[model samples]
Target: MTSSLQRAAFAGTYDDESLCGSGLMVVRAEAEAVAALAGRIDAYFAAACKLILACNGRVVVTGMGKSGHIGGKIAATLASTGTPAFFVHPGEASHGDFGMITAQDVVLALSNSGETPEILAILHLIKRLDVPLISMTGNPKSTLARQSQVHIDTSVREEACPLGLAPTSSTTATLAMGDALSVALLEARGFTREDFAFAHPGGSLGRRLLTRIQDIMHTGPEIPSVPETALVRDAVLEMTAKKLGMTAVVDGRYRVLGIFTDGDLRRLFEKAGDIHTTPINEVMTRFCTRVSPELLAAESVRIMEEKRISALLVVDDDNRLIGALNMHDLLRAGVV
Candidate 1:
């Protein structure tokens, strides 16, 4: 019971094959453009990395229009990956922003045609300051390319745009070139995960790599623990009071002997045992998973997931209970 208008509204589109073909064509074109850059990583690319590595001041990246957007991202990637870099709009460079650049700084300029007016306008200033210039462009003979100390060829065979007007494949080629530079610098500087974590402290990768169990675990009286001689009722009371759904059964030295959880209660209920009179040690899970306070919170998450457990008892080298945490803590700390 479908109306003709409803069917037309839902299904009246261009041919599916044509739409899919267009998308595939664009993707293939961009892939080819990126692939073509592999062979162009010659001595000039290595020299560019050396210049940035030897630079004492920050890298100043500039471009016009769409190239500017790509330049900003490239600068961000470089700064986060160990190189100190920032973006400057080519138009703004003519203004007072040009003061941000110094003789020690390296300039990375991008333009598909290699003749953007704004970029060209600032070339004389860069020359006067004696700053190293690296140009990424499609035209090798363009003024910007010829003037640069290191010229990267980011030429694309054709535009992904069917009209051959919009900068689609050319922009992709430029972005890939930027990524290549950043990664080369990153490897050259021996950037580690710890350094990356410091740069991205607010990100999930930082939380996973930098956060330790001691940073987020519940310590002191917040831990729900009872002597192994305690009764099931006492254990249940401790679990309920702490709201951790579990309690660690420890010895007089505070060494973990077993663990009692809500799951134990469910299994106990199936038997005729008296809850109040039963010793927790007789019904508790003897083989319990334990973690150290120094362990990474991300490693704790992996252990919990693999063991199918929600809570873990934090123990010291002597296997004595020092702290405790649950899956909820990890989730709250953004480690999950």
Candidate 2:
């Protein structure tokens, strides 16, 4: 019931000594090309890195067709990793997007053939605008390379496509080269995890990497708390008022002396005793786990999970109570 085209497509992916071997061969060749470029990461690489690092504006990357798509991706990678960058289609550059480029910016152009017409037509304009040019191309002697202030040779041995026309290995090499440039810039600038967090503030990684305990901890009146001399009823009231299912028992200076939780309440209610007059000191968990405000919220999550507790009291170095946080707080902060 299979059609000829579908059968042919499926058959290309079968067997060990077939076109699949050729496919892997092409990939291996491209990987070798990228590895060879590692030795060329010298003055030209340094100059390109310096150009982008010294940029007071942004990195405007441009290309045409498949190269343009790769350029867009490279621009995004650079931007997310602390180097400010964006992409402009070369075809669109003639349609007025070129206004986005400024004298303070650097232009990173990409082309596999190194002779993309739309890209070449703008070489003089880039020079006139005084924007430094860095090109990634397969041919070192191509027009883009000759016109570039810095040329990164990303040549490939062959196309993975059997037709030898569709870009495959060449694009992979170009992307890897872009990654090399981005990581080099990231290190030379001494960009930190905190800096990366700012760029990715909306994701789970952002929450874990950027947020501190103080930023998400429950404090002030929201912290469920009771005095050491307080009765069980009072502890219950504090827990209810804060809706955190627990309360920290403090001494005169608000130092965390013990903690009473809903589970403790359950145990008390189930015991053969009158709850009305029992002091929380008799029923509170004195050996409660505590954390510091400077600790990462993710670390708190680990501690809470390890101890099997739903809440924790945050204290200062002096053991004085500072704040409180619960599983709900972690969930709300997106740390969970």
Candidate 3:
């Protein structure tokens, strides 16, 4: 940050330290809790991963209270990261949601205390179905852990809550553990960006990765172009009509020969070239940058920014002009 911005940002902090100390302590405790989890990535963690990977069905995550909330987020992360998973509240599981779990699926249950009655109520049914069980709990000797095929200990030294009654450090540690598992499984499955984009196709990130040049490029009459024999004025009229700030100088076969952009026009005018009489081929840039219609829209953005150009011409394998697009097209498509 600039010095002035730094001063403005810290202007009130010198006097508020007393009021902020409590929040600082809470953050520190949670940070320590997350830090301590690095050591717990042991054989038990591997066992859980193996069990989930071997399952042919989705992972069913269940928990009570705060753990349930954590489980829901964990399931979402897992689902988006390549693992097929869903959260089923323990309280709901005992009622009728137990039907969600199947013999082909793996059960990932969360209970900080290792003994949530609702979770315990369905324990017998899980075993009867012969489904593999993975439990994450603070107590290794708890009923949930004792029966689980694999147990992951997510214990924190203490709660961040000063009263030691609220779930804070424990929940943070659980979330970190969930993220660790999610990313590990993501890498193990060889998940690619396209795979991630397929799961998330509603946002800018999805548009950037999934959108292709063909999807947004202007085709047919929308492309700005003029034959090499045309005057600079003709190219200017074409560029203005297409509103792409540039025009392609093509041959009689509609093959791209060069590009005439706003920058080229400015340079030509500096040299006192006549826009109405000068041949476009003489002033246009030769061997202009071209892109494949199948290329990712995000990659096109990278190319445009690197080359410091606003427009790109698309061509076929035979070098025929197929489409055109500019930075504005990308912006409107949300690929920028």
Candidate 4:
């Protein structure tokens, strides 16, 4: 019974367009709200930052429902970025998690309405413990905000949800503000990638930045190398024995001068004369890629990829061949 135009309008306008429009509107409105409030940081925000910075223990973030979800994420961001923080459920706080909070700890409480009954119940206990309280609420004059040592306004003009009822824009604004705070504190404290590696030592970045080159390269017997004056036959034997697809050609002192690979063998095989009698120096590539022992194995992998090579010679400051790595080595080490 519906006209095609009506169906098209409904499909194109309210269905497909609505999603992006509403999401963008929510983010734009939230960004504006945060920018407006940034000018109002005043004494309250300063007090909150000061209290948190002075605390000897962790920041205990707590809230109920959607606010609780945001609080947990904020706590994680803060902790990963150099601030010691964790989230406690408001319901659980009243049960036993309240004991987790110490006098030296700071409380970062969230409640959009500033009237989460469970959080309100813990205000007195928090005060009694002399722990500084930082409240994030929409209502500045509400019980939780008024009772706190510092308050951040997370008020939203309206919900981005058309029904005017969901915690869409409000929660987004709170999360953005939380991220801003955590990143600011992280930069102020000079938190580095190495510091982050300690907390996330199982992930890709932890493995890449935290792992040393010595842990992954092929050394000792597995290293493929030949003396500079060695016959091409002997160098090919070393490469085949080590199974690295290439062999480092070094002088008597073990100073690496070049490398010989399968590519060189293929090129030499077509020669009109005796190739086995040829010296490795005659067929070796003099300007081959090399890396230092102290360099990251991941970086060495990148060099190999960029140079379109299958193997790299690891050398010391004096260019002495000490190790070697190939694509297979990188794959096995998880550095690829």
Cα RMSD, each candidate: 4.9, 3.4, 6.7, 4.5
* TM match of model 3 to true structure: 0.90
lDDT of each: 0.95, 0.90, 0.93, 0.86
Position 212, candidate 2: lDDT:
81
Give the alpha carbon lDDT tens digit for every residue of 1-336 in model 2.
999999899876666787568868777767776777777788888889999999999999998999999999999999999999999999889888888999999999999989999998888889999899999999999999999999988887777677889898889888988999999999998989888889999989889987789999888878888898899989988898999889999999999899999899999878865567999999999999989888989999999889999999999998998899899999989988
Candidate 1, 164-242: lDDT as tens digits:
9999999999999999999999999999998999999899999999999999999999999999899999999999999
Global fold similarity of model 4 (TM-score): 0.84
TM-score of each: 0.88, 0.85, 0.90, 0.84
Worst 10 residues of 3 by lDDT: 10-19
- Estimate, for each residue in 1-336, the C-alpha lDDT of model 4 and write its tens digit: 999988887776567687788778877866776666676567766677778778899999998999999999999999998999999998998898899999989999999999999999999999999999998998898999999888988888776767778887778878877887788778778899989888788877777787666778889888998888899899878988999999999888989999999999988887853557898888889999888878887787778778999888889999998888888877876667
Clashing pairs in 4: none
Worst 10 residues of 1 by lDDT: 9-18
Cα error, residue 80 of model 3, in Å, equals 1.6
Ordered list by TM-score, greatest first: 3, 1, 2, 4
| Whole-model alpha-carbon lDDT for candidate 2 | 0.90
Residue 43, model 1, lDDT: 94
Candidate numbers sorted by lDDT from highest down: 1, 3, 2, 4
Better of 2 and 4 by TM-score: 2
